[model samples]
Target: MDVVNLNQFCIIFPCYVMMILTILWIWRIVNWVWIRPLQVEKSLRAQGFNGNPYRLLHGDSRDMAAMIRDAQSRPIHLSQRNILPRVLPLHHHIIANYGKASFIWIGPEARVLIMDPLLIQEILNKNNVFKKPTPNPLAKYLVCGLSGYEDLKWAKHRKIINPAFYLEKLKNMVGDMSTSCSAMAKKWEDLFEGRMVIEIDVQPYLWELSCEIISKTAFGSRNEEGKKILKLQGEQAELTRQVLQSVYVPGWRYVPTRRNRRLKEINSQVCTLLRSIINQRQKAIELGHVKGDDLLGILLKSNEKEIEEDESNCGMSIDEVIEECKTFYFSGQESTSNLLSWTMFLLSVNKEWQDRAREEVFRVFGNDPLHFDGLNRLKTLTMIIYEVLRLYPPGVIFNRIIYEDTKLGHMTLPAGVHLLLPIILLHYDRELWGDDAHDFKPERFSQGIAKATNNQLAYFPFSWGPRTCIGNNFSLLEVKVTLATILRRFSFQLSASYTHAPAYVVTLQPQFGVQLMLTRL
Candidate 1:
């Protein structure tokens, strides 16, 4: 109890504390890189799966990054088997080496392939059983909506947002989409005035068109603001994609790094603009100047109804709604633009199909404005679109995480294992499709999606089941209208400068740009 004895005890206690802390840190690393992964590897091996053995700290991350860098460093040549290797270097390597049902580690967490049609269906169907994992911080900040929610929150959001993308609602917005396309076509016409045909890279134009269409259709009067968001989001998504592709280190965002600070600033800038747009929309709703028809109006109206119906089942916060708006702008614009770009590229390659599609479009509406009725009648055009989607899907893969021990097919998966459903692989699978699965065959889907894969869950460019892309109908209508409008005004073919490289950023886009030579019809 003496002071001198107390001082001695304090000095010794500090050293003991430091020793214990260091031991705990080392044990955590041991568990991550060795003990825990070994246990997971054992479980997967029992299920007849094989893959690269885990390495300390990085696991397969360094290998994946190196592969990606190597892939990017090469020339983007066309006509050979493309996309799969470039988009998902690690996955392609694992599948090629260890077979389809192989596992690879992203840090310590194992991602095992589930390539069977029925098993993939089961995983997607049970939304709650297989939860979506938290994406990189930049991804979450840039785009999160129903993709990020679970349980009650997901149910409520899905219910309210359902009407926004219904066939009926999407039909009403077809004009906005078509009108935007027409403007673009007119601009093209002007640009190629004296020339019989003009060669232009159409990706940037399609990107702008889609952005304008989504902004006008969703936010109505606030498209000017939406344009600002569109510019910022494009940059942010590129940055996020880079971050996700790298070997992710936890707490990297917290450090005062240059990229981190830039991302934070972009986030703040976007949030501020979005808030202004939202407030303006809210004021308009209060004034009864607009119906809850536009996406923003509809979402707010739907959320308000939920709150009125039950206070405990609260609607989304303003910030959550802002996030949803970001999701709408980015995904809606990205997918449709990619779809249109790829379809144009395909049509340019297959001039006979282009002639047939144009013939159909001309027969449906003889120099008239492209409308929903005319679009419905263009079955050939629809067939071409479906075929392009099969060959070049916007999303190469879809992932889900297991939060609890669950049975996928015949075996039980532990909570930490992630399910990897490579949709592009299935789309190109000869077993599901035909000998010409790798070839462009629109006739395959002339019989409709069900008959195309013999009632299989093989084609899901927009995904499938309960959590299907809510903007599916919207995107389709927009794409149909845009393609029809362009086809009517111009007869196009692949330009000599055109290169066929399907790149996978957030979406599968033409890496070298879709260059087409168009003549006024």
Candidate 2:
């Protein structure tokens, strides 16, 4: 009977093990699907906030997607809703339903929408709590350098990379910026066939300008390799767009699909290009052939200085430096180009404003070529550029992820949730800018941005606070200089063929291109 009991116990042991495993699995499912979300919902409810009930599996993704489709299919307008049906359909609805501060769910994720100027200011101020969210995984495939990293690694990279964009360092690059602008100005000059209305898509011209500036600044005299990197980066961006538009399966990054395979190939090519350029620069330095204040040289010197000052403040690892160089190459190219393109588009539309800007450009710059000091005096031009950025910001919205439960204004935010501040929506809020918010009025900003938004944190073209764009000064100077040069030689107007569809791809861009009729002034 004892032997029988021992055999029965052995049989029951397997059953008991299965039962315990099943119980653990159920607990995980319950915690993830119901219990955790309910706790978050309760916290939000206590704050007097309400949103759609979180579904077990889908959450609000399906509803959000449907609403976006419907809203986008309506019509494209100045409002944010018509911008990207697939991305922000809930944008219009949230504004309509919850006034300024509304909440929405995106696949078990709660994104609190803050468009109120005061709240936007508060969130942007608390950078410790409201840090920028990582882009979707596939974005790393496209811009896989500094913009992708997070946590301590990101902080370290940001520190090492900060010196390259100092105003004095950037001022030294003005000649290179002017040289690129001159090249584009020559292109426009060639197009002027004696009152000949040449239909030109300015995006490529602006893209070339940006590429050349990055090439000269990042690579200095050795821009041949930088041009190749630019080509591969463009290809990578295109491939990235294709990947982003596809259906995302879990672990898609590791899968061996054609898109994935092509992405890997392009990424390899881009990396090889960057590595070769870095090696060439290093070799030049070793052989004592390097010169001037090009970005790479300055960065190397800065890194070494930091190391000498403090062991703990050591320079970036070789791999880290390479990644940062790639980031500078890509970001520098994309941002300046986008700003130039949009500024030209807006100027084309508002010819009165364009004429006023041209007048200011001439008033400050005169017959003399653009100088650092002269660039500063173009106050009216600066106001016009500021206004353009306000309406057509490069990114529609920026997101901040909460790492812990924190008090935001009168509300308590949950961990793992996102605080989304829609810059475009905030820029267009009638209450913030009066009834003419949607109108293109540069004069409104003539008194400077402080008076424009009543000193609210409403006008941060390069963002605000400690993490504001490091290159804001550089970018603004480039924009002002480039626009002054272009206006000095040629007059432009929106062509009949032009379409006004703005789309977001790394930066907000004209989808159909900004077609303009160029005439020699």
Candidate 3:
């Protein structure tokens, strides 16, 4: 009788365990789809934020995807105000349809779109509560290292990387920038002989110019593999574009689909290239024959100094160093090139501004090879670059994920909600820039940035405060040198084949490219 009772008890235990597993699975499903969103939505609504009603399963993901696809399919004409959706659709649409401070659902997540500049200042300034979101895993695979870190890791990385981009360091890179721009101008001059109208988009040349500058300025003489690096960087950028188009599916990267396979393949190639560069740099460091103060040398020196003083004070591991190198190559090359291309494009259309910029360049340098101090003296040219950056910023969309409950404007946001700060929308905002917000007027920046927006946070081409692009000084110096050198050498006009389609990839780029007719003056 005792044995039979024991057997019956063991059978009941198995049944009880199965029931518990089933309950947990159901709870996860319910919480993910309904419970959490409902709670967040209720809280946001309580704060007086009005937005589109959330759809049960889809939320706003479907609409967002459709909008992205539709935008990519059409040709972008810069003359039109509605070339692209106003940065954040929900925020722009909510303001248009509802009012200021409306909510939008972004895939089981509800976010309050804060349009007020004062509110923007508060969020950007308060660093602890609002931080960069956990990056998408796929973004990590494609381009890992810098933008992937959050919280303490981010703070540490930023701290270590800060010294490399200081004003003095940026001054050191101006010569390389001048050399690159000079080489590119020579190529255009050859095509410009006999006043022939060459139908060429200057975008590709600008990209090459920026890549060469990054290669030389970062690696010095070690930039021997720049061509190979450029190829890998281009592939990585294209893959990122493809990844953005498709909705992310978990573990989908491991799947055998053609797109996934191709993406993985690109990832493998970039990894191999970066690994090779890392190996070369390490060997150079071991040999104790450090080159000039290029970016790589500075970074390695900084790392070594920290480790030698106190191992615990070391900012990053060897792996992190390589990742930062890759980030610098990609980000530095992409942003600066996009800025130059757009600046040139804007200058092309506005001939009066172009001539004025040329006069400024000539006045500053006077046939002397471009130098760091000379670049700074070109105040008019500097204002023009700032104006172009304001009009066509490379990083149009800035996203920050909320890690804790935070106050934004009048709303109290919960954890797991992402705040979308649309830099593109803010830059063009009439309330922020007055009636001529859309106009490309460099005079707005003549009095310096503080007085530009009436001391508002309306203009942030390089972002604002803590998380602003670390390389802004480096980028500006490069642009000033490149523009100065190019303007002194050749005069250009818009090519007939040029189409003004400014669109967003990872950065805002000329979709069809910036076509310009060149003539050596």
Best by lDDT: 1
Off by over 4 Å in 3: 1-12, 76-78, 86-94, 221-224, 241-256
Output the better candidate (1/3) by TM-score. Answer: 1
Model 2 agreement with the true structure over 1-521: per-residue lDDT tens digits:
59999999999999999999999989977876678877887777677666777777567667665664454344354333234343355665666776665667765567777766787788877776787776656657566555556667767667767788887887777777888788888887787667566779999888878877787787775567777777777777767755534435456678787867877786677778777777777788878887736877777777777788878876677767777777777777777788889899888878888898889888887878678887888888988888888877776777788878888777778887788778777787777899888777888987888899999877776778766776678778888879999998878988878766665555677767788988887
User: Which RMSD does model 1 reach against the true structure?
Assistant: 1.9
Give every collision pair in model 3: none
After the best TM-score superposition of candidate 2, give how far the Cα of residue 429 lies from its true spot, in angstroms. Answer: 0.8
Candidate 1: tens digits of C-alpha lDDT, residues 275-323: 9889988998899977858888888988899899997877889988888
lDDT, candidate 1, equals 0.84
Please list all clashing residue pairs in model 1, or write none if there are none.
none
Cα lDDT tens digits for candidate 3, 1-521: 59999999899989999999999988977786789888888887787777777777567777766766666566655576443353334445666776766767766767566667787888788767677766555666555665767668877777677778877888767777777788888888787557655667788888888778888888764455665666676776777766654446457767787766666676677667767766677687788766647887778777777678776775688778877877888888889888999888888888899999899888877898878787778888888988888888988877777877876765668888878777777788887888988898999999999899888888888888777778888888888887887788767777767866666777888777888877677
1 versus 2: better TM-score goes to:
1
Instruction: Kindly state the number of residue pairs that clash in model 2.
Output: 1
Roughly what TM-score does model 3 have, to 2 decimal places?
0.93
For model 2, which pairs clash? 68-89
